[model samples]
Target chain A: MSTASVPLPNWITYGLMPLLNLLVAFFISGLVVWWIGENPLEALRLLIEGSLGRGDAIGFTLFYTTSFIFTGLSVAVAFHAGLFNIGSEGQAYLGGLGAALVALALDQYVPWYVTMPFAVMGAALFGAGWALIPAWLQAKRGSHIVITTIMFNFIGAALMVYLLVNVLIVPGKMAPETRTFLPGGQLPKLDWLMAWFGLKLGPAPFNVSFLIALVMAFLVWVLIWRTKLGYEMRTLGISPSAAVYAGIPYARTVIIAMLISGGLAGMMALNPVMGASARLQVEFVGGAGFVGIAVSLMGRSHPLGIVLAALLFGILYQGGADLSFEMPNITREMIVVIQGLVILFAGALEYMFRPTMVHIYQRFKRA
Target chain B: MDFFDIVVSILGSTIRLSIPLLFTALAGLFTERAGVFDIGLEGKMLAAAFASACVAYLTGNAWLGLCGGIAVSIIFSLIHGFASITNRGNQIVSGVALNFVAAGLTVVLGQAWFGQGGRTPQVSGDGRFTPIILPFADAMREVPVIGPLYANVISGNNILTYLAFLAVPITWWVLFRTRFGLRLRAVGENPGAVDTAGISVTWLRYRAVIAAGFLCGFAGAYLSIAQSAAFIKDMSAGKGYIALAALIFAKWKPVPVMFACLLFGFLDAFANFMQGKAVPGIGEVPVQIFQALPYILTCILLAGFIGVARPPKAGGVAYTKER
Candidate 1:
């Protein structure tokens, strides 16, 4: 029977549905755990404890959360302008390069406080630069943004490989990575932030970038909801025909939204390169861009939702790492499985349970 | 190696590499022509590769492995169908989810089953698709021109490679000549029209996606059982996306799809052949250029810099009868 004709409550749409989807995703993930002869309930306990039990674990979890927040916001921004950007992985890669260039030039001379702002701009610009062509193609040429973005991801990888191998490598080093950034380039740890809880923050790389991520989230919220440009973007996203009729300037809105998206994705590099590695390396983005898509979908493309969703993934990643250590049979890739299930249940089959829920809700109301 | 031998080797490698692309691109052609966009071909092929390798190692039969691969791929296709068709969800998001699931699930299952660091044990004997020597290949090897072309390029390939080539003409016939073809194409362009005409849009799309799964399964089986000895982590690499790019490059037609795969396969072969080799004037070009060529060319084609590559009108949209 046809369903979903009636509007459900906002509480159901935003809150109950997401919670149900997450539970289903976790349930299936537990099945995978069971298939490998592990106790799913025990595994869940270990996951929660490993990610949140200690100060260092919490720091690590929040560190991962920071990157996811950037990426999730990236996807959310583009999504608002009716673009599905799958190239944030590549953009983040380029963003790392942008961040590295700044860190490299200034680390020997200036303090990180002096280098931070420029590095942020550098990362965002590089990421946006990588996205420019796909955005331009989608805006002006009517090319499918998805395909172009996907292709650009490969091209960006190739370019990065070429640069790292041929140009950026230190003259005497064997590795493709650049030399380590000095103290000026390095982000100070948030150990103090952790110590305030009277717990030692051991080796976690939680740093100032988390704060930046929050600021970006707030900015994204403002851009999507408050500004005139955001209004045009939302207008274009909801209906291109309607936007055109309303004179929303489709090309400008699309390009600007993508730039913001790409820039946010690019800023994800700050957490890893400047905060953790203190140097740029290959594969630093490491599927965080893809995780962003999941975060955005799960969060319903809202900034507040994205922050929470990113935190959820951060817990999974940090906890999954611990689970792998405890149960060798389950690898770190288990987190990826959980991530996919979340996307499947929350993003695609979001309404699969909606009809059933609506039916039950209506039945209860009738009673 | 002599020039002729080099040509034969490169040509042989091109065909070998292109088979997966050929199969996968043709698979995409069907689903996309029926108006479903899938970015999960890579994941499907990777999952199927792992499944095929796992089954071949256990059953000691490549055919059984092939069946296993196809079965798993079909299951994924059904999932995609359930999401996009029945649930009326975002096709790209659904595809993205499937890709991740396949990628993560395969490696996880592989590690759990084999305990070889996410790699299946190498399959040999009947578990592998050994090349069948075409008649008179040794005799023809000594002859010039057509002899080496036929003996080396055409012959000495596994059964799946030959099937990949044959699928091209069959795909053309099925896509353009049959009643199902016309209806499928119509649905991709205007599902509403097809629905109004009393044809089931969902059923037709599901069939198209299943056909896609069937072909992608062959592609994955070829990758593990025919092309390689065992499953490797991320072994499909970006071939699925390359095949998707090729599908767009071919503009979703069967014959053109074959050519696009061949072109990409040749680019790959040529890149590997040219690695560490210096040109007379330009010096040694980086191999990444060749690696990136297919994507660059596809991007150019996509931007209407070359001939415009138009997708089906109703592509990427979930069709609802009520709408």
Candidate 2:
């Protein structure tokens, strides 16, 4: 650890640092669990079991990850367009409402397969519409998307609370939630198919939605890295003036990026409604969209990075509960502290340690 | 007195209600004009409220407690500005993190200090800042609209209320009539230009943030000592965000900003009035509906806009000078 010497490669700088940071995080957290009177090994055991233990745990974990993947992608896409879509939470709520309404309507009028896709499409439309307003304003008026999107989140939350507590309240229920989705509108399960294989013997709660998220994740990679549209989005994100010089339609690119972002966010509700719970409930999104910002940032706004980040977050979320049950007086809210710490470190990584590390590298190189 | 009496009372309540907002909004004007988005205003207010309430409860002196609250909030603001201006961290993330830290730490600290989870011990009446009855208020109570307006609306407020109102005109003069205010505004809009003109961007932003922290401290003290006797957890609620909105809706101008705070304050006062009263002729409105009027109006204002409002160009971006 010389003060100054070597020039570290960019690969090591970006790749190894994150891994090193996570290792350090786990080491500290492990000690924290120990101080609370819980065995570190046992806590680890429970964490693994809770996230990947058997059929049920796997199903729930995968379900949770699916929604996160979409929302993470939502944030990532907007990041590519140089905009921050903090309104993913609001957009997802609109998506949930849209999907729920479609599901309820089709319960009386249409077949299952036909209505299910319609439900998803309806949600996509509403979500896209929600994002376009801020997108348009950003392009035309130089308004910061960051603040506007946050404002939109507030508006969305109020709107959802009002609608759910009023008009969307299923005829007689006192709860502020909508009716359950029709069987036809639900996402199909592949549990029995997995049962044919020896791998399905566990408590994994994996479903078709998980696969849908993976497929979308893959598509996002291709669309972002390989396509011309992705190139335009990237250019615009990096420098709008440069993008204009390159003949890209800057405004159109911005609007389309937000629309895509919103559509992805809308798709997230599918996991909870169609796969996991099959019902529309208040606060159902459970801050998953907000968590998406952390995931996207941690992933460095790359599609592959986002997929892995979502899975990691999903595991921590599921495991946090199991640890709470095993260890008395230690609740799942502790996970929130860990999550916030992770965001703080990730967002301020360079500020936190880069100076010391780089100085040491410079000394080594000179020596 | 009849309708006129009721109207007079409403006017009085609105001014009293607007005091906290007026302070925070003016604080917002200072920081934002210097090109920093103080989304942490709500968090700062909450911290100040907690500190003031606890200190006043312990010391039995409201003035000392108020100063303590302001100092604590200024420290928090410096942390925010330090992280944002020096570290170049994301402003939105920093704001959110500060809010969360404030929310959690306040409760944890309050519980440890007072044995209550999210509340402090109430202070005695002698420890609370009560309004001083001035002859100016009594003498003007009889004049028609202007006299009643001055007496009912402006005269009968705690010491902090007078300071908050005075801040507006002073702020206006500073922003437009003074060198420091001009530099602050120039820094906020474009720090590079300010730096090119030989101004220290970081110093300007830090000062602006400190000023904001001091003002928010007053806002918080007003909430706890002047308005209420004890600090409640999450009492700031969304007032900070509301002030941010008011700042933007005012186009960051001092005079318009005052009107914006008054407007929001009136809506709040009206909500309180409608709680148990029936509309002159129509049946009574639901209390919940009245309670939600401000949030509903915020949503409408958000969705009703034709275009996005522009903030200072470098408002949230950190300025790093190349030596």
Scored by CA lDDT, what does every candidate get? Answer: 0.93, 0.77
Write one digit per residue (lDDT tens) for candidate 1, span A119-188: 9999999999988999999999999999988898899889888898889998889888888999999888
| Best-fitting candidate, scored by DockQ | 1
Residue A147, model 2, lDDT: 62
**Estimated TM-score for each candidate:** 0.99, 0.84
Question: What is the per-residue lDDT of model 2 for residues A266-360, given as tens digits with 9 covering 90 to 100?
Answer: 87887787665677887778778877887887788888888988988888888877766776444564455455555555654335466667776
What are the RMSD figures for all models against the true structure? 1.0, 4.7
Model 2 ranges off by over 4 Å: A1-8, A19-63, A108-114, A188-208, A274-277, A319-337, A348-352, B5-13, B56-61, B64-68, B107-157, B224-233, B271-310
Model 1 lDDT per residue over B105-210, tens place: 8888888888887889999999999998999998987788889998888999999999999999999999899999999999999999999999999999999999
Interface DockQ of candidate 1? 0.81
Task: Single out the weakest 10-residue window by summed lDDT for candidate 1 chain B.
Answer: B108-117
Candidate 1, position A350, lDDT: 93
